[model samples]
Target: MTDVAIIDYGMGNLRSVAKAIEHVAEGRAVTVTADPAVVRAAGRVVFPGQGAMPDCMRELDARGLRRAVLDAAHEKPFLGICIGQQMLFAHSAEGDVPGLGILPGEVVRFDDARMVAADGSRLKVPHMGWNEVWQAGPHPLWEGIEDGARFYFVHSYYVAPQEAGLTAAHTDYGVRFTSAVARANIFAAQFHPEKSAAAGLRLLSNFIRWAP
Candidate 1:
């Protein structure tokens, strides 16, 4: 049974992510839960988030899912989306906050100097809407998706993994930033797959069937 647990720490778009997973789950069970037991027992885990880093971390701790998340990441196929991806790093510049330290890196703000497009148009902070992602290397989750496919994004800060080899995909905003990362059993995306349409769905579907 492909029992997948979407960790509900009170910040992510839980329902949307659950629905997407359910769409591709086939016979797998999908549940949005904050219970650590449920998270620990699931075959796969998805950590999705939107909003402030401190708030996300607070809720994660409040719900007592931090350790459960770490445990799950270590033992099974784990996916993190948006700020869910940022939190995996060592820290964040958003609120000068500390993250899970699962990955060796810090989350930093997009540089203020280059928030302008090449065509001389001003760009927004959230970096909302569609952008193309360049695959850095091969991985199971990227299987049916093209090398440069657009995905939905909504965030101001981005991850800076200490080691470059961990990066799975790259995207150009004001500056180039890490859009996705994959290493061993854990994979994460700085963009929101539930809102990313086809390419997003392909990634989610791959995550569902992924044995890694």
Candidate 2:
């Protein structure tokens, strides 16, 4: 069985993600660890988070998980979720803070001024709730997932990759933005798969089956 490690850096929804992975893998070994040694030994890594960009970066740095994660991404399969995905970029407008710089891009907030609201009120910053994901690209990470499938999204900022072909999926708020991304062995989703229901489970399963 494949051993998967969900990096526990004190900010992610770690338990739910681990449970969801267990549900999909059945008998596979899934462990949530804050230790860099365990993360390095795992066959796969899932970087999950539900917090601010700046705080996430600080926690990873303070805990020394940043280098471990980057090393794993280069050699093994790495899955990042929510704020986890945002950290893969170069920087974020949220705190004007630098990211892990795994992928060449920056995270930016959704501008409500450009959107036409029904009540004439500005669209909320944190775009919570279910939204349809329009998948693009042919990466193994999205192999079984279909286009227009709804995924649970809860974020104010979205990733804009330097390479357009790296965009695996997109979602619309005030404007369309990249919701999923894949480059080589690294994969990430702006939406929360653990909170996305069946479609989300299928995505997780696909990740489990994906071989680096």
Candidate 3:
């Protein structure tokens, strides 16, 4: 069985993510871990979050798992979900907080000037509900997923990576923003695959089979 560690950084929906991985990977062993040592030993690490970027970074620093996760991302398969993906950047405009600096970019809040709501309600800040993803690269992590397939999203802020190649998929809210990113062994998604139904499951299964 493949050993997958879901980092418990006191932010993400760890239980839901673990359960989703189990459902997709079949008999694979999944553990919700907060220990850096345990995370270091895992074959793959899934960092999932759904809170402020700065608070998430603080939790990671306090637990001393930042280095372990970054090293794992370099040497092993790593997946970041929601704010977990945003934290991979250098900083976030959400709370004037510095991120893990693993990836080059910054998380910024959706601008009303650039966004337009169909209902015309000043464009909601937290972009909640299903949004279509337009695939960019030919990364194995997105195998079997169709372009423009809708995925579950619930985020107020979005990542804007400095490197364009890192963006694997994009979604349109008010403007087009990164929905997924992949660079070598590192992979991340702004959408919630656990709650995205069949398309999301297929995406996770692809990640399970992806080779770093």
Candidate 4:
């Protein structure tokens, strides 16, 4: 059976992600590794991250897994979550840091002026808790998931791909932003699937069975 590898770059809740994957992984091996070799060897890769973009990038390079990550992203079925999704872009306004450049886009923060609900209430930054996600188009990762499902999210920054077609799904905070992206063998989401209850589990299960 093809094993699933969750890249441990020392950010985010790796254990929660690991446990969640293990729950839906069936008999497939789920290995959380900091080693580049293990990442390259795995059949599928889950790139997950949290915290600031600068720190995330620094730690990734510090561990010498940058090349391995890029390779796996290009060569295998890949899933990116939270900061993992942000890091895939070419740049981020968080620390004005450059990303993997795997996708042509930039990560931007929610505007303070626009952080208002329909009721004229102030919305907080980091955009925590559950929000509805609207599918941009059909995707394998979205299988078994409803078009507008609520997923757990906790981030201030969101991705804006130059190519609108790259967006797999979007969510509204202060504005409509790309909440998920899909291209080739890769699919990424700004939300935390592990924390998203039944809908989250369904998405992970779809990823496990997804060929691409």
**Best by TM-score, which number?**
4
- Candidate 2 residues 85-195, lDDT tens each? 999889999889999888999899887777645566677778989988998867776667777989998888899999998798888777889999998898899999998
TM-score of every candidate: 0.97, 0.94, 0.95, 0.98
Return whichever of 2 and 4 wins on TM-score.
Answer: 4
lDDT of each structure? 0.92, 0.88, 0.87, 0.93
Model 4: lDDT equals 0.93
Ranked by TM-score from best down, the candidates are 4, 1, 3, 2
Off-target runs (Cα >4 Å) in candidate 1 are none
Q: Is candidate 1 or candidate 2 better by TM-score?
A: 1
> Which residues of candidate 2, in runs, are more than 4 Å off?
117-122
Error (Å) of candidate 2 at residue 26 is: 2.3
Give lDDT tens digits, candidate 3, residues 9-74: 788567778888999887888889899888888888888988877788898889898998888888
When 1 and 4 are scored with lDDT, the better candidate is 4
- Output the lDDT of residue 174, model 3: 88
lDDT of 2 at 40: 91
lDDT of 3 at 93: 97
